[model samples]
Each structure stands twice: as C-alpha cells, then as structure tokens.
Target: MSLGMACALASACCFGIASVLQAVAARAVEAGSASGVDPVLLLRVLRQWRYAAGLALDALGFLLQVTALRSLPLYAVGASLAASLAVTAVVASWLLEARLSTAEWAAVATMCAGLAMIVPASGAQGQHPGPAALRWSLLGLALVVLLIGALAGRFADRPRALLLGLGAGAGLGVVEVAIRLVESLTSSWRGV
Candidate 1:
C-alpha cells in the first residue's frame, strides 16, 4: 500500500508537469494557422522540445500508474489521479504565470483534503478473480467507445474535441479496470 501510494503520487506529479509543458508547447504555435482538429498541428507540436519532454513524462506517468494499480484499489488510484488536476493548477500558476483566484486556491486545498480522506480508507487490492462476464463486458465497451470516437472524428472542432476528450477519459478508466481483471485472471491461471 505504501509503495502504491508513492507510485500514485509520483504519477500525479509527472502528469501535472507534463500537462504544463505540453501547454507551453501548444501556445507557442502560430494562432489561426490551423483549425483545432488539424492533424498537422500535432506534427507541429511534436517538433517542440517541450512537447517531447512532456511525452517522456507521460510515458513515465503511465508506468507509475500501472504499478499503482497493481498494488492499490481502483478507487484509491483514481483519487490520486484526480488530484493531478490540483497539481496542474499549481504548475500552471507557477510556470505559465497564470494567476489563481482565492476560490481556485481553496478548491485546490479541498482536493488535497479529499485525497487525504481517501487514502486511509482505501484497502489493499482485492484477490477475487472477477467474473469472465465482466471482462467480456469491458471488451465490448472498448469496441463501442472506438466506434463512437471514429464517428466523432467527422464532427466540427468543438464537438470533436469534446467527444475525443470524453473518449480518452473513458478509455483510461477502462484500462484501469482491465489491469485489475488481467491480474486476477493471471493469478488464477497460475494457481490452476
């Protein structure tokens, strides 16, 4: 649990820093040169050093997240990941020279307090081999999400952005749950 907590916090920090770096890179691009949905903009952003560094950080965060998921309950890891928003807020304030109102600071504090409450109540990862039906359901959901995301690609900028963001979040959530399911299946197999 302690190790999981450490990994979770590290993951949050990496993700937070990466977000700011990516934002800096994005902001450097020429405004109005391309639409928000333009794939060329991704290529442009990838050429920036900050963007590369952000990608490296994101990779590290992903590894840390996997480690945390293996050792901690989904809820606990989820809470830690959610706290990354607070970390991003702070990083943006410092690095981007963005100002945070008093209310924003209070919200950050509230997020921290909520995380503190969650950690103590979270127990170790469960050993149960979740039903095969659950794994199939997850697989089905992933396929459906992929279809929706593909359809969303045909929309205008704002709607596409919203749908893509929603799809990404759902995909990540599914990955988290799938990790646990995989672990359970593997452990069960080894015992057979």
Candidate 2:
C-alpha cells in the first residue's frame, strides 16, 4: 500500500479508538446541572484520562488525515474515514466487552469491502483546485452550521443531539472540502 493510504488507515484507527475512549469517559462522568449544552461538563470530562487520550488521538488523526489528503483523492480519504466505524465496533467489542449482533458484524464487513473497492478505483486527485465560489459556499455552510448549533439548544435531548450531529457532519464536510481547496499547507490561512 502507498504511504498515503497507510496514513489514512492509521488516521481511521486513531479516530475509532478515540471514539471508544471518549464514549467510555463520557459515560463514566456524572451529569452536570446545566440545562443546555454544558461547556462545564466538557471541562470536567477533560480531566478523565481516557477522554484526554481520546482528544490527543483525535489531534493526531487530524494531522494524519491532512497528510493523507496531500496524496490521496478526497473520495478515498472520506471512505477511509468512514471505515473508522469498523474499527470502532471491533474496539468497542474488545475493550468494552460489548457483544456485536450478527447484523452489526455484517455491516462492518460491508464497510471494509466498500473501502477496499474504493482504494483501487480512487486514482490520483484531479488538478483543479476548488473555485472561489466553492470556498464562499463553505463559509456560508459554516455559518449555517453555527446557526443550527445555536438553535439546537432549544430542542429536547434526543432532537438536540440529532441536530447537533447533523450540524457537526456538515461542519466536517466543509472542512474536508476546504482541505482540498487549499493549494499549500504553508499558506493554509490564505487557502481557507
């Protein structure tokens, strides 16, 4: 495998492992009295070793992701990132002693298969950098995501969580596209 693909997979692994650690830490902590999204609870969770480790891994994963993006097409990189769910399931089963249903196992297998198929098909990235309009759109999307997040606090727990998840997913997409738009890592500020 190429170094870029390897980096993508490693990034996925880091993210997957980080997710489990964060979940464990989040679950272990007691709920705070804050009515809305509790910033204080985040500070509290930061004290947990698992959570801290998870954050560190997330940072590493992001850096590795950028490295992967330098060589791999965005589609391949996105697939690799999605494949992190497989890692998460396996790690969760092992570390948390959680049993996976047959369906879940099958899903994980499918994700792996999809990623395997994508790797060979994902040739080199195209030469075209994203247009100025696309960058503007990303900025617009960012604002929309921020707005959604702001309004999400009004919903009950389940709906709020769902809204936040959607917003975060959109935000991630913006970042992914923005990374592709940037021509140079050194001039990242101007790129974004």
TM-score per candidate: 0.90, 0.90
State the C-alpha lDDT per candidate.
0.90, 0.90
- Supply the TM-score for candidate 2: 0.90
Summing lDDT over every window of 10 consecutive residues in candidate 1, give the lowest-scoring window: 30-39
Residue-wise C-alpha lDDT for candidate 2, range 151-177, written one tens digit per residue: 998899999999999999998888888
CA lDDT for candidate 1: 0.90
**Per-residue alpha-carbon lDDT of candidate 1 for residues 107-192, written as tens digits (9 for 90 to 100):** 99999999888888998677887899999999998997798799998998789889999899999889999988876456689999
Clashes of 1: 0
- On a 0 to 1 TM-score scale, where does candidate 1 land against the true structure? 0.90
